[model samples]
Target: MPGIGPLLGAEFLAATSGDMSLFGSADRLATYAGPAPTPHDSGRVSGNLHRPTRYHRGLQRVFYMSAMSSIHFCPESRRFYQRKRSEGKRHTQAVLALARRRVNVLWALLRDGRRFEPAQPATGTA
Candidate 1:
């Protein structure tokens, strides 16, 4: 667990390591990552968006586990968590959003068959 952090984890990579062809594209990646929420109709009531995986538990666990660490070890993740809290999102909601964001980035990488782009330093008036 040394130097290992969330928002990216061994689990995520292992879950995604097989069959790039199975993903097909980035949008499909979104769906696979549990970011693509489902239509929740509550018996003549409105709907909501959330995860529901009867199948991809390992994959979901990857994101969730990563999320758990990201809040503690990642600056950007911490910032996002703070921002979401300020915006009135509950702690879980904030974390879920962060996980989905990471999923999108991973999706882009998968789409291009490329490794992750390193975190670029912020450029400002120096």
Candidate 2:
């Protein structure tokens, strides 16, 4: 929500058909959006993951663009992106990870009908 603008928001709504019920869960939505990789494992070739072959590119673009914009506008997003980079992820991979996380948040918000609220930093008292 922090990174989503008018156009991206409209695109997301159109992609999702304005109904969370169709997805049933955030994982499902992510899969549809192409952020959730599919396994290409066979016997000894385990841990092999690849992009899904059939996903809504428009939806993926919506999430990817929002994730990229969030890195500059949202502190939490920046930190997450930095952490992913530290963990050996490339820029695109980090952004995709953030996008997947955002999908979960968006799904929860839609399911609960709540607004996005940034977490408050904790203060230490002497």
Candidate 3:
């Protein structure tokens, strides 16, 4: 029953490029918008990690759609998609990885005024 105001509610739709970029990248924006997935990985498998919690449906839709959209619109994200696919990860599986990775990038972008950059391979840190 709360957040009924247009500003506080779901009435806001992006109207321009500037408005969209204001969130830095989709992941941070999705996180702020809410509904980002709760990653549940212990070793290899992901996506179907845990039972769904009491999260806002609207927020989840926002993040999911935004992640999918970025796959088409965001160049860096698209490259990640291809890379994940090349690594033998399935489509949805790769997307979930991207979403989880986006959460961290988004958090950082929101904290600092930088855009999301894909991580480079580590040098013998393993």
Q: Which ranges of candidate 1 are over 4 A from the true structure?
A: 1-10, 35-37, 40-44, 47-53, 110-126
Error of 2 at 13 (Å): 0.7
lDDT of 3 by residue, 46-121 (tens): 6654545554445445445556767887777788889999999999878766666655564565467785565675
| Candidate 3 colliding pairs | 28-106
The best candidate by TM-score is 2
The Cα local distance difference test for each model comes to 0.68, 0.91, 0.57
**Model 1 lDDT tens row, 11-95:** 6667778666778775565567665567887887777655665446677667666766878877777787799989999988887
Off by over 4 Å in 3: 1-50, 113-126
Candidate 2 lDDT over 16-84, as tens digits, reads 999889988988998899856668999899989897579999999999999999999999999999999
Query: What are the RMSD figures for all models against the true structure?
Result: 4.1, 2.1, 10.9
Worst 10 residues of 3 by lDDT: 1-10
Q: lDDT, candidate 1, residue 7?
A: 39
Please give the lDDT score at residue 120 for candidate 2.
88
* Candidate 2 residue 95 C-alpha distance from true site, Å: 0.5
Sort every candidate by TM-score, greatest first: 2, 1, 3
Per-residue lDDT of 50 in model 3 = 52
